[model samples]
Each structure stands twice: as structure tokens, then as C-alpha cells.
Target chain A: AQSVTQPDIHITVSEGASLELRCNYSYGATPYLFWYVQSPGQGLQLLLKYFSGDTLVQGIKGFEAEFKRSQSSFNLRKPSVHWSDAAEYFCAVGGGGFGNEKLTFGTGTRLTIIP
Target chain B: EAGVAQSPRYKIIEKRQSVAFWCNPISGHATLYWYQQILGQGPKLLIQFQNNGVVDDSQLPKDRFSAERLKGVDSTLKIQPAKLEDSAVYLCASSRAGGQADTQYFGPGTRLTVL
Candidate 1:
């Protein structure tokens, strides 16, 4: 079974500061990873996804994540944090088979931007 | 393209009551999914439909939860005799197909509060 782990429950970063959200996954084979953002009272929105391509994948809102096989991590990073970036982020793992495209997500990390 | 759509943005019901959520996927989408997201936790897949057929529903509690996608475009998830623990956000997502690389688009989700 594939599982994702997000260590940080909540994080606060000053506006214009760099931010990184840690994500770890446990999967037997090459896993398809994804980053999703959810605002309060809103559904999730895809940030980016990693299949079998470049290690670094760029997403919307100037977010990027690097897939590190050695560490089994796909951490989300943003150079400059904006007040609008404050939201809950989730890490998910997929790709078990054809009928197993469903994703297993981590608990999520709530980000707060302080001006 | 328009994103997935879910009805009843918020619902409050007493314990043991019945509730249903409706979802309309993006046009031409062949895959639809229902997920349960508890507060402070990641979303968990409850059921998945591939063209009006069940592809995955192992996690759904059949005794209380049931879902169906008719005509392969719209879906509904119903919970009978809901429990207090069942109070969570029910999210509906849709994808182009059942491919591992297909990105899923989510709806605004229906927040369920069982009193």
C-alpha cells in the first residue's frame, strides 16, 4: 500500500520568505506523486504532479517540487511566499495499477503567511 | 473548461439521519471519485467510478455509504444513518480517464456536519 506522510501540521512564514513543505512517501515501485492545495471551505486544487519525467516539476502559483527517489520525498517549495499562499497543502501518492489510480494522501500542512 | 461541480456546499444533519451529495463531473470526463476528508486529515477515497461502472470501492463502508454514477456523467453519494464520526467534507473529483497520469479536478465539496 502506498502512503504519504507530511510531518508539519502547520507552518508560518513571513511574506517574501522562502517556504518548503516536507513530504515523504512509502511505495514499493515508482510512485506518481502530486501536490494539492485547499483553502478554507474550498475543495482541493492541483498544484503539480510527478510521473516519470524530470526530477523537478513546476506547478502553478510559482510552486515547484523535486522528486528524490533516494529519500522518497517530494517536497514543495516556493521562493517567495505571498499572503494568498496561505492554505492547506496535501501530498499524495498514486500509480499502483490501472484500476488503482486512486491516491493516498497525507495529513496535510497548513501554511500561514505573516506580513 | 468548467471544473467538477458538487451540490449543497454545506449540510447539517442529526446523527442517524440520511444525507446525499450530488456531483457533476467535467464534460467528457470518464472517471469520477468520491472522497471523505476528516478535519485535520487528508482525503480518503471512498468510491471511484469509471464510466458509470465501479472500478474501486474497497474503502467505502457499504453498510452505511453508497454511491452511483448514472449515464457516466453525474454521481451521487448517499450515507444512511450517518454517525457523528461521519461528519466531514465530502469531495467529488473527476478525471479524463482511468490513466495513472490523468489529473483529477475537484469540486467545492459538501461539508457535512452531523450533530
Candidate 2:
């Protein structure tokens, strides 16, 4: 079974401040990680994904995540968060294929930005 | 390209009532997925379809929940005699089904509220 853990349930940050959302996972094999964002009344939008390349990968909307194999973590980070960036973020883990392509998602972290 | 599309952005129903939601995946996407997301929890995979065939339905409640992608393009999920626990956001997502790690595009999701 695969699972993702997001330690932060809710986080508040001021505009222009750096932000980091922690995500840890438990998987037997090399995990494929992803970050997704969901606004209040919208569906999730893909932020980035890590398969089997560089440890760090850049994503849309000025977001990036580093896959730390040893720590079983793929935390999303941004140099600064804009007001529009505030949304619920989720981290997910899955296998490449081999009849195990379904994804297991985290509880998600709700981000709030203040002026 | 247009993203995944789901109908009935919001629905309110009484307990034990029946409800159904529809989804249309991105063009050329062969893999479609349905997920259930509670208010404060992450989205849980309920079913997965690979071009009109069922790939996985382990988490879906077979007794009350049923879904079908008859044409492998548009899909529908139905809940008969719905329960209070079933009140949540139903998300539809699709991927290219490349036999490898692929990003799943999501729909706006249908919010179901059972009274």
C-alpha cells in the first residue's frame, strides 16, 4: 500500500514570503510524486511531478519540489507566494505502471495568504 | 486543450436519495478515474477505467456506488440510496495512459451535500 503524509493541515503566510509544504510518503519502490493545487470552487491543477529524473523539478506557477529518496519526502517550495496562490495543496504518490497506476493522495494542506 | 469536465458543480440531496454525476475527460485520454474527497481529507480513489474497462474498483462501495464509461470518453458515477458519509466532492480525472507515470488532469468536481 502507498500513502502520503502532509504534516501541515493549514498554513498562513504573508504575501512575498517564502513557503514550503511538507510531504512524506511510504512506498516500497521508487515512488512517482506529484503536487496539485485546488482552489475553493475548482478542481485540482497539477503543479509538478517527479518520476525518475533530477532530484529537483520545477512546476507551474513558480513552484518546485525536491525528491529526497532517503527521507521519503517530496516537499513543495516557492520563493514567494502571491495572494492568488492561496489554495489547498495535495501531495500524491503512485507507481509507474505494472497494474499499479492508481494514486494515493495526502490529506492536503490549506494555504492562506495575507496582505 | 480543454480540461476534464464534470456536470452539476453542486448538489444537495436527502439521505437515502439517489444522485448521479457526469464527467467528460480530455480528448485522447484513455484512462479515467473517479475519486471521493471529504471535507477535511484527501481525495480517495474510488474507481479507475482504462478505455471502457475497469482497471480498479477496490475502494468503491459496490453496493451503493456504480460507475461506467461506456464509450470510453464520457463517464458517469451514481450513488443509490446515498448516505451521509457520501456527502463530499466527487472528482473526475483523466490521463493519457502511457503505461508510465503520467499527470492526471482533473475536473472541477461535483460537490454533493446529503442532508
Best by DockQ: 1
How well is each residue in A1-115 modelled by candidate 1, as lDDT tens digits? 8899999999999999999999999999999999999999888999999998799999999999999999999999999999999999999999769867989999999999999
Q: Write the per-residue lDDT of candidate 2 for residues B1-115, one digit (tens) a residue.
A: 9999999999999999999999999999999999999999999999999999998999999999999999889999999989999999999999997354777899999999999
**Candidate 2 local accuracy as lDDT?**
0.94
Q: What is the lDDT of candidate 1?
A: 0.96
Candidates in order, interface RMSD in Å:
0.8, 1.6
Looking at candidate 1 chain B, the ten consecutive residues that score lowest on lDDT are B94-103
The prediction achieving the highest TM-score against the true structure is 1
What is each candidate's DockQ, to 2 decimals?
A: 0.87, 0.72
Please give the lDDT score at residue B53 for candidate 2: 93
